[model samples]
Target chain A: MKWESVSDFFAMGGYGLYVWGSYLVAVLCVIGEIIAIRIRRRTLYKHLGLRKRSILRGEK
Target chain B: MTINWFKYASPASFYFLAGRMIPYFSIAAIIFLIVGLYIAFFSAPTDFQQGEAYRIIFIHVPAAWMSMFLYVVMAFWAGIGLAFNTRLSSMVASAIAPTGAMFTFLALWTGAWWGKPMWGTWWVWDARLTSELILFFLYIGFMSLQAAIDDPRRADKAGAIIALVGVVNIPIIYFSVQWWNTLHQGASVSLIQSPKMATAMLSGMLIMALAVWMYSIVMILIRARLIILERERHTAWVSELKEGVLE
Candidate 1:
């Protein structure tokens, strides 16, 4: 709303790259961390499943 | 009335509690960030001196604060764990390191980007910047030392020592600008003094800081749950949880 147009907004009044660049790094790191943490949880569940399956097979 | 403080100390209970708590924190983080960035980019007026470059401080300052704050929290938990031999305490310290490191990296990276335009240099050996970099290394050293050790107990103890020893660096990072003649600007907002910036800018930065805090809690809780599971994998409760025998 502060900018006259969309271009002005992205330009950040001549500081577009610096402002957005810092935010981009933050966004990427956050997204990457979320994915990483979720993946770790998924991997844990998968390992549990494998163990359960192995135990069942051995009992049979 | 007596409070059973140790009730949640067990990993199994803490795991479920963390799972339930994470959604609330994550949602709060999302809300705060959206509002904060909107105010930062749209509502906050451009600075008289710095034009738009000052906007980077929303992310940079908060990240920098979190980097130092989290380290202290991590060290506190690590120290407590080392003294009392509390499993959850050490697990918490371990869980905090990655997020702490991430914020530290963000602080440095964003500081570089912000500096390039304003200071006309992408990097500097300014006391503040150098001390912050050392804090980053401290985080790395804590994590690496833990990973190198095979035994979790030993790893936690070793990591705790480093974390405790590294607390000295945080005050250094904070006072570096004051302690030494540095290129980095001193604090814009301080508890002891009136804020130097406008209302809108101050609010946006504070909101962003809150968002960062919420995000950290969510991440730390998630990672802590995972650490709990991995370390307690051999326990009956973990096996039962895996088998869906204990819901």
Candidate 2:
């Protein structure tokens, strides 16, 4: 609220680049982790499903 | 009744326990972060020297602390895995590495931000900063080494060794200010003495530190659960777990 406008908020008293850059990197890292975990889960589930199906067919 | 501490060390047991713990840690992290940010922004007075720029310390110091703390934890778990050949240990270590690296990067980034306003530069090669950069590289090296190996057991062992070797750098990073002529200020709130800052500032920093700790625990628990599911996919317990969750 101290920042008068959107532009002022981004400016951060001339520390716009450094402050925003740090925050951006941190947020992106968290986002990356979430994406990586979801992908890993999907791959693991598919692999397990395939293996289970193969074993079932072999048993048949 | 005695609790079986070692039981939870088992991958399966840890999976369930970490699941339960995650929500608690997540809630605590959120509460503490909200409170800490409020205090940091509103209650703590601005510094005469650094003006509003000093507010960055609230996040920066906590991030730096967590960066170091998580690495030590990762190495500890890695050592356990190597000694006992336990799946859970390796999983814990792997879970912590990425988060540790993130915090390390945050520390450096915030430090650079703070530096630009006070020191008139975006970057510095001070002793503390240099050692912290090495810490970041160490995290990347550990993750890469683990990913490169085919055998999970062999990968854990190799990662453990690298982590142990990297442990030597932690002490160097902590003591760099005392050991060398560094632009970074020496510790103001060391364990040996009362903090030099005002009570409000110290309280805000401590609250932020607690929030960071909670956040790390929650993140690590989530990661470790994912590791458990991946590693234990062939086990009957995992099949049961999937069935129960799907239901």
Candidate 3:
């Protein structure tokens, strides 16, 4: 609402690069953390499943 | 009816509780983030002095606050675990390190980005910046210390000592601006004084802070649940959980 056009919003009154740079990295960090956790959860589930199968087979 | 608070102290109960709560927290985090970003870019008026560069404050301030706050929380849990020998408490302490480290990195990164245009330099060897960098190292130290030990109990105890000792740095990082004439500006929002910014700007920062807070809770709980699964894999309950999942 403050900007008159799309270019004005993106230009950010000449501080655009710094503002966007900060936000871009912040977003990437969040995404990276989420993906890392998901991978961890999947691996954990796989390990647990294998352990359960081994237990059913009377193996330690 | 008395609700037994300690009932949830066991990882088993806490894991399920966290699982149920994650959805709600995730929703809250999303909503707050959207609203906060809208207010930050659209609603809040541009700063007259700093122009648009000041917009970085929303992320930088919140990340810096969370970085320090999470370290304290991590240390508190670690200390409790050390005192009481609580497994879940130690697991929580370990779970918080990565997220704390992430925010610390964000704070420094965003600080550098904001600094480039405002301060005419990327970084300065100032007290606040140096202390925050040390906090990042502390997080890495805690995580690596735990990772190096084969035994979980030993790792937790060792990590707890470091975490508790590292608590001294937090207050230093917080008061650095006031204590030293640092390049970084002093806190705009303080407990004893009115905020120095416009209402919309203040609200946006606060809302972003809430969004980050909720997001932290979700990440910590998720990681804690994973730690529980890892450590408790030998237990019958974990085996039962596996069965429940398979079905």
Instruction: Note the clash tally of each candidate.
Output: 0, 0, 0
Q: Report the C-alpha lDDT of model 2 over B1-247, residue by residue, as the tens digit.
A: 9987799877877776776677789999999999998887668876767666777888889999999999999999999999988889999999999889989999998898888878888778888999999999999999999999988889999999999999999999999999999889898579988788989899999999999899889878877877787778778877765555322
Name the runs in model 1 displaced over 4 angstroms. Answer: A50-60
Question: How far out, in Å, is residue B166 in model 2?
Answer: 0.7
Residues B1-247, model 1: lDDT tens digits: 9998998988777887887788899999999999999999989999999999999989999999999999999999999999999999999999999999999999999999999999999999989999999999999999999999999999999999999999999999999989999999998788999999999999999999999999999999989988997899889887766566665
Q: Distance from true position, residue B19, model 3, in Å?
A: 0.6
Q: Highest lDDT among the candidates is held by which one? A: 3
DockQ score of each predicted structure, in the order shown: 0.38, 0.19, 0.38
Chain B: TM-scores of all predictions: 0.99, 0.97, 0.98
Q: How well is each residue in A1-60 modelled by candidate 3, as lDDT tens digits?
A: 798999999898999999999999999999999999989977886876664433322111
Q: Give the TM-score (vs. native) of candidate 2.
A: 0.89
The lDDT of each candidate is 0.91, 0.83, 0.92
lDDT, residue B8, model 1: 93
Residue pair clashes in candidate 2: none
Model 3 misplacement above 4 A:
A50-60, B245-247
